[model samples]
Target: MTNRLVTLFKFGIVGVANTTVDAVMFALLAVIGVPLLIAQVISYSCGVANSYWLNGRWTFRDAAREGNERAKLIRFLITNLVVLVLSAQILMSLHNMLGWSLVMSKTLTTLMGMVLNYMASRYWVFRLAIK
Candidate 1:
């Protein structure tokens, strides 16, 4: 596979792991009486933390090291914060407004955010410096 494809494959793997973490946490929190919105934020935060650590060291390791470490972390946080807000909104709309199950709403929101998440991670947060 080409370099981009290889990187995408790795990102996909991390995304699965991240999704697992998010879903499990969300389910646990919800079952324990946490509000859906709060559960969504807390669970997604866990996934974001996992994503930063793994994706930095594994999926995007070959990305050009143009920026400082602090800057990279900040970018990653901002990108994820944007994604989280959108995901939360979508989840709420699907579950509350549209009368979907929580599981179905969460799954759809995650799928909807996946591509945009990957694109921002690759092109903005962990940008490769062109040779």
Candidate 2:
């Protein structure tokens, strides 16, 4: 329990870094005339790639195992794919349907995605292997 909390804290820190990558890249592409959806796809992919290494090394160090980094990265990417789809829907709803600013919608979706990622990472992606 306590360990989970500590891990969550570390996860949050890593998430901020990842989110910054996503957001900054999104902003860059947006300024260059790329559509938001396409920008998001590219930005989020970059972030997820960064996330696997950071979370595996830091947030769930003990949960990582030998001989399975490739498998773990695949699982991590799958989890992020689900989360990204969900996030895109939410972003579309808030920013496009509801007329919120893109930044605001992205912020809201980022929070939601962060929670989902933590849950998935803890339970599925980074779970300690049983004997």
Candidate 3:
């Protein structure tokens, strides 16, 4: 139980780091006149890269090992892609239909997707180790 809590804490830290990367990149792209959709894709890609590195190196370090890294990366990408679509839909709905600011919409979407990302990564992406 204690170990699990510690792992969760680490995961949260890594998540925050990823979020920072995403927000910064998104803002930068937007400032430079990139389309909102393209900025989102670029930011999310940066976040995904950060997530894979931090989660594999720290959050799930105990399970990281040889022979499974490629599989793990693949699984992680698949899970992230799903979450990305969900997030994009939510953001678009809030921005287009509700008159919310893009930043606000994206922030809400990010928070909502965090749990889904964690669950899918833990249960599906990294399931091989536990089994």
Candidate 4:
């Protein structure tokens, strides 16, 4: 496979791990009476943390410019913040307004977030530096 395709494949692997962390955390929190929005935030944060570390170290390692860990982190945070707000709103709308199950709502939001995240991470947060 080409380099870009390889990076994308690695990203998919990391995404699976991140999603597992997020879904499990969210389910645990929500099952124990935590507020839905709060649970979503907490769980998404867990996933974001995982995404940053793994994507930086593995998926985007080749593209990463050296000595800019802090900058990359800041960019990752900004990207994820945008993703979180959108996902949370969608989750709420699906569950509360449209009478969807929490699982279904979360699944939908997660998928949407995955796409947004991959784009932002590839083209912005972890953009390849022009040489």
TM-score of each prediction: 0.75, 0.77, 0.77, 0.74
Compute the lDDT of residue 50 as modeled in candidate 3. Answer: 96
lDDT of 4 by residue, 11-127 (tens): 899999998999999999999999999998899789889989999888888667564778888999999889878988999999999999999999998888888988999888888
Candidate 2 Cα lDDT to native: 0.87
What are the C-alpha RMSDs, in order, of all predicted structures?
A: 3.3, 3.3, 3.0, 3.5
After superposition, the stretches of candidate 1 with alpha carbons farther than 4 Å from their true spots are 22-43
Would you give me the overall lDDT of model 1?
0.87
Residue-wise C-alpha lDDT for candidate 1, range 33-71, written one tens digit per residue? 999999988998899999998988888886635667788
The Cα local distance difference test for each model comes to 0.87, 0.87, 0.85, 0.88
TM-score of 1: 0.75
Model 2 C-alpha lDDT per residue in residues 21-100, reported as the tens digit of each score: 98899999999999999998899888887799889888888778643778788889899889988988999999989999
Count backbone clashes in candidate 2: 0
lDDT of each residue in 5-103, candidate 3, tens digit only: 887788889999998999999999999999999998899799889999998878877566533788889989989888878988999999999999999
